[model samples]
Target: MKKQILTTLVFLGIIIPAITAQTTSENPYADSYIYWDYLAAYKSGQATVAFNNIDAMLQTYPPQKEIAMPRELALVSLDQLLHDTDNDQTETFYTFINTRMMRVLKDLDRPVEKGLRIYKLYNDGFIIKSKKATVAIDLIPGGSNAKPFIKDSIIYGIAGKCDALFISHWHADHANLNIAKSFAARGKRVIAPKGLWENVDPMIQPLTEHIETDIKFDDLDLTLHVLPGHQGDVLNNINVVEFHGEGTVAQTGDQWGTDDLKWIDHVNEKYDIDVLMPNCWINNMKRHLVGFGPKMIITGHENELGEHSIDHREAYWMTIKKMELLSDLNMPYVLMTWGEWYDYQR
Candidate 1:
């Protein structure tokens, strides 16, 4: 059934890509230009060759349209690959996703004049860019093993384009000492909690808790209001970021439990947020939505961490169920897979 759905989507995308509206696909399908040699080889048990083909293809894949059917195709393949334990021992899984992440880097070069453009990386990783400045939120290198998902150049490449890096918490997946160092070395601001690597790296800046405390980034032309949130007992910094003219966006970094609800329940009264970035899974999702009261919601933290357990990894299909629950609110939201992006105009 999954393969059938993927085939149908790809077939429709190939037919509709010719007609485009600037960055959007006319029909939300995709272009006819995806290379299928890798999928064919994967079926034939030539895993390494398939990985090589995908690597070559992703390195040069033209991102003319933002939402493509091919992206759906790639994600379906990734979902299957992560579960296939045979490939876990090999470098194939990480190689495929990392290559796609590099594709996201290619699109960031284009400037956004009117509103902020957001690129969704693996898990909670996002790149929010406007004409004024570029910011990376929870931008992590792929995989949890000693072997990194992305290369050093890709990490630095992302660091080079951004003016600041905002880390929500010290979770291994959300925060990276090396990536933080890249931003800090360039004199760009790196805001994280003083929990994980703060002692190791003094350059990391911890924001004051509570929304009343607004931290100013004069050099980057940005203002931040942080909610001292917690994921279980761990401190999670729920960032309410204000860009001068582009409008305000609130990012909830692994916000869990009822401890933060004191502020979260009244977030709507505090500020008018244009976009709300939140994890798809939480104990009280709808309440969080009402509190933030965002014009639109772009959910992250879907299908991340590692492939140790299928359930823990959190599949994209699960997000479909999550959105179904939130449908009654009539709130706008985008459920993006790894390497997908959405641009917002406020």
Candidate 2:
């Protein structure tokens, strides 16, 4: 009898743990209860449920906490759906649903409540935003030009609650007539170089604001300073964004020169830059690093979009290889734009 009892006890121990583990996995509503619940609602295609739940989450949590969790979870779901599709085990409907969700998830990361987000808009144009400011930059579209990407980027940045946006130039690819109108309709304010507003569509005219050479907003906990530079002896305007609360990011736009480098030196002296987002300017990446000493560098106009006149699809990777040759760096220290978002973290 005693021997029988011992065997039964051992069996119970193993069985109980297994049952408990199963419960843990099945209870998707464990710690991340709200996210899991919302995921279920999204998966069910219950639009009302999803919207209501999201509204609740917005009210309940800070923007960062609210958006990050759902976005990440949605990505996980979409990736799984994609994998299943690739394996030929999923239907077209599943793939479509996942794609739609992915877009929504990406949208949720805009600069909200002081958060920072950068998304790849259409081709070269991007909208950069901070807490209360937004800038739309028009890049010459084609392939390597930096326009459409900025469109999506602008929304992404603002969705993350960034304060301002910078439009580097008035090139065709960088600015879109119809899209600019929409931004105006949405009441998005933009900051740009001297000549940019002159070239923008009149529909967006009201949204445009010319940033002075040096503009200070004490309430912003930051400053907006314009830096003028030349790309291969051609004058190009750039925006210098300085963050005082914690971190700082310097955007070179399409400008590169002795003048810009001088501004970068001032930035380095004044504050520590966490990231440097610059367009490829005659391959002078090394010079800026010296002046800015940013902890990370994210390049723009690098991704190649086929069927397009110009594409810098491999610009980021190429820069990485070049940087590697100069220094064995791989991550945050060296970075490049991928799409509406950075694929590295994904």
Predicted structure with the largest lDDT when compared to the true one: 1
Q: Report the error of model 2 at residue 22, Å.
A: 58
| lDDT of candidate 2 at residue 130, scale 0 to 100 | 51
State residue 310's C-alpha deviation in candidate 2, in Å.
Answer: 6.9
> All candidates' lDDT scores?
0.72, 0.46
* Candidate 1 lDDT score relative to the true structure: 0.72
Candidate 1: clashing pairs of residues? none
Cα error, residue 53 of model 1, in Å, equals: 12
lDDT of each residue in 1-346, candidate 1, tens digit only: 9999999999888765533333352323224434243343344345655666544544344222232455445444555665555666466666666666777778788888878887878668888887788888998886654777777778678778888888888877888888898888887778886455555455568754433457788766778877778899888888888888887888888899796787789989979899888887766889999999998888888766564476766665565567678789988776565665677887
lDDT per residue for candidate 2 within 28-103, as digits (tens), equals: 4444533332444334344333434433443343222113454434333332332322222223332332333345
Off by over 4 Å in 2: 1-106, 109-115, 120-164, 199-212, 216-222, 232-234, 243-246, 258-267, 304-314, 328-331, 334-346
TM-score, every prediction = 0.77, 0.51
